[model samples]
Target: MADLELTGAEVLGPEGLHRDGLSFRDGVIVAANGGRRVDLSGYLVLPGIVDLHGDGFERHLAPRRGAMKQLDEGLVAAEAELAANGITTAVLAQFISWEGGLRGFDFAAQVFEAIRDTAPGLVTDLRAQLRFETHLLDFYNELPALLREWHVSYVVFNDHLPHERLAAGRQPRRLVGQALKAGRSPEAHYALMQALHAQNGEVPGALKRLCMELKAAGIRMGSHDDHSAAARADWRTRGVDVAEFPETMAAAEAAHAAGDAVIMGAPNVVRGGSHNGNLSALDLISMGMCDALASDYHYPSPRRAALMLVASGVLDLPAAWRLVSAGPAAVLGLHDRGELTPGQRADLVVLDAETKRVAATFVAGRTSYLSGAIASRFIG
Candidate 1:
């Protein structure tokens, strides 16, 4: 909670970018500039990136196969990565799926407990988001209570099963490998998939009931990898307003038409397209269909993609940066930290102007990550 002032930087606030000084105290931006001044004449100061959906923390949680250990340690490491990448507020997208091991309910419960315990001491404002696989009929009755117990406010529905192939009694690709990872035999895994898919008749009703319950609990819901306009519309009717990475333009258009926030991966933009041959994020942005960009699997992609957009003339600096900041913040209902405005949380990212690299990250007026010559500015 040290008072600090950043001077001579081109700061982006609610009014837009301007050369000015910013001051903060007791974790909030204030009008009165009273603090030790640090000159940053050639830097760009902007609000910290808000990532609405990121699973990059999964690598830190379980770096390799069968290496899962302490959840707190992994969470600490994840926060360091997030801060280093200029993320101030993040929603860790942990899966509560049929897939066992790290993505299953037991591991998710561990993550929930760890996050709840470790969050107060962390600089980054970390929150949990549950990615629920919709076809898990047995868990339909139990998920709402678990989500409430975990204090998770955001939930995204995903149906990752290759239902067509499974229903045909054909083995989905890499079934053995997936089963091995889940600590089960291939036969057991196939049986599980068949049993889950066989309950498809009951899934619709179960999903409707679950969504209604979650909506009543004040939990914001989203649909993932929406493949069709009809699919998006169905989720919309069930109160799943946020569309996370619609795979087709029609799906995205449906979400946009319904006034829902459409999220795409930042890495998709950085890489120029989706790795899985889905809709291109850059193309979506150009069409005015994309609302926000999440880090997805790559923690640094948000900043990289924003700059990429600016360099490519798809958007100017303010507009491009908004994809990583204000856009995601609004989607996630975090109105406090996405802008460097007075009376807001003092979460800012300072970038080296020439290199366009993150030089430092500040969260709630505290220096969370600092490096290079920028580190010399604070003479403590």
Candidate 2:
């Protein structure tokens, strides 16, 4: 890539925002200016967003049931959306759950393979995260091998089974639709749920063993939708140090107390609360409980959420922006590409200062996205 000196924009540095020129060459930020200068007087340049978890790519991969089969093309399209939203590094959370169809094992494997194949050609840094349903006991023994084979390093344990309904021998809500989507009869699906529920006693032991194996393999682990302090503590004990969207304040607090990274959905912050009536992400953030903000299922929410926090006085610009950038990079143990500093990867987003919309995004010093009047500055 050609070296370029970006000048006149308000650059967000590690200390704070300043009117300084930023220069990069060979995909790395540099201290000395050596390239052509691009004046960006009306823009604000900040570290590119590092989205720790998101499933919004699902719509791109499969817009509708059986709508798109070219997984590689879908991934490329997804990268465009991510770059437009100012995300440089994104973790696509694919599910390996009993809930079949797109979230099933076969589809997830295809998605992972597609990501691996397509990422090298794409500018956005796309990574895979397997969201494995904990109740899939039969699949536990094979998970470590499967993850390694798929080149997935991040795993999040999820338990979405309606245990209370199952224990009461009642059918879960939307059983018929769920079964149809899974390509199974309603009776078979219900039976499967009951069977999975029955194996609850074996789940904890299985999870412990599985966590140990994954830990040995250097895989990062997290727990999803944790509901209580005890549950969060239990997962932490099992070496799952990241908590994804803990459902209760107690769980979030427990994760924070134990020094685990707590990832809350950025959409929750933008919308002012959880859509399902769970504990509010804004509340957690205000109390210093949140470690980072993820895009979740909305690619644009991370940027919007950080700005909203600043507008509402919950945090200053730097602190709020960190939730979407440096904070997330830290959570994922990424030592690079979250800050606009010398020697860091040249990953940054330029926003219109007046409207705060993404005008351009650069990943590894290459233009991943360019739009509006800013396109002229880069091209000229």
Tens-digit per-residue lDDT, 273-372, candidate 2: 9999998999999999898999999999999999999999999999999999999999888878788999999999999999999999999999999998
Where is model 2 more than 4 Å wrong at Cα?
none
Off by over 4 Å in 1: none
Backbone clashes in each candidate structure, one number apiece?
Answer: 0, 0
Model 2 residue 16 lDDT score = 88
Error of 2 at 210 (Å): 0.4
**Tens-digit lDDT track of model 1 for 277-300:** 999999999988899999999999
Question: Model 1 — which ten-residue stretch has the worst lDDT?
Answer: 61-70
Which 10 successive residues of model 2 have the least lDDT summed? 61-70
